[model samples]
Target: DAMVIQNPRYQVTQFGKPVTLSCSQTLNHNVMYWYQQKSSQAPKLLFHYYDKDFNNEADTPDNFQSRRPNTSFCFLDIRSPGLGDAAMYLCATSRDVTAQYNEQFFGPGTRLTVL
Candidate 1:
């Protein structure tokens, strides 16, 4: 099936360490998004790629960064992992979320543990 997939369902990182989470999709959607979810909190949008254009949310911290080398792959890089940074990283894709009729489809997500 054409769907989004995230690798290393679980991840562990030390304080100040750098970690990278990956996502890939067969859906061939034009928009790819990354979101962070903490316990008891709604998922926050970090960034997204609409084709080759990258859009990062204003509230996204400097510690979070992303890369989309191509349409099928996207990567989230944490420059410095903090204890508070532990959370689930979700990867999603959509044809066009802004359109009146478009919607999003998400991956299972990567759970990060700061140690």
Candidate 2:
């Protein structure tokens, strides 16, 4: 019954600047996921971690990078913020990849604005 947490609910950055979004969870879930959601569009899976293993979606841009130093925390680092990169970044956790229900807990999300 643990929860996911994201820091700095809102963020603003200048064009070409670097920005990072952070997420943490008390759930100790084995799988952690990062997603990008833009206005009027479904969330797109950027990457995920199963324990210490990192998995990035084939279409995920090189500008986006993630790090999970430990089980409870994950970070999304944007190397260069672009106008089109402004969106809601989400963090989710699940017990494991092969769970029967594959239920997940999601954070409130960090809204990034590129100026």
Candidate 3:
């Protein structure tokens, strides 16, 4: 089945370092999302870009940024990582969340560790 794919499943970075997580989709879905999960807590939606339109969550940190160059690729950039930034970064996709059947497919995620 088609799904979302994230690179560098395990990432270790020093404090204050910059990191970038890559995400790609084989399903060619219209909506792409980025999320952060700390420990056992529920994943928090950071932002998502639909086609060329980008929408960010009201509470998302200013340190985070995203870019979707085309339909198949997206990237999450963390300008400066702090100790609290360590978590599992997830990438997901769906046709449209507002639609009746908004089935989102998630990638395995990239585990980021701040040293």
lDDT of each: 0.94, 0.94, 0.94
Q: How accurate is candidate 3 locally (lDDT)?
A: 0.94
Q: For residues 1-115, what per-residue lDDT tens digits would candidate 3 score against the true structure?
A: 7878999899999999999999999998889999999998999999999878999999999999999999999999999999999999999998876767478889999999999
- Tens-place lDDT digits, model 1, residues 26-90: 99898999999998589999999999999999989999999999999999999999998999999
CA deviation > 4 Å runs, candidate 1: none
- Candidate 2 lDDT over residue span 1-115, tens digit each: 6799998899999999999899999988999999999996999999999999999999999999999999999999999989999999999999988868479889999999999
Compute each candidate's TM-score over C-alphas. Answer: 0.95, 0.96, 0.96
Ranking by TM-score: 2, 3, 1
Tell me how far the alpha carbon of residue 74 in candidate 3 is from the true structure, in angstroms, after superposition: 0.8
lDDT of 3 at 49: 90
Q: Which pairs clash inside model 3? A: none
The deviation in Å at residue 63 for candidate 3 is 0.3
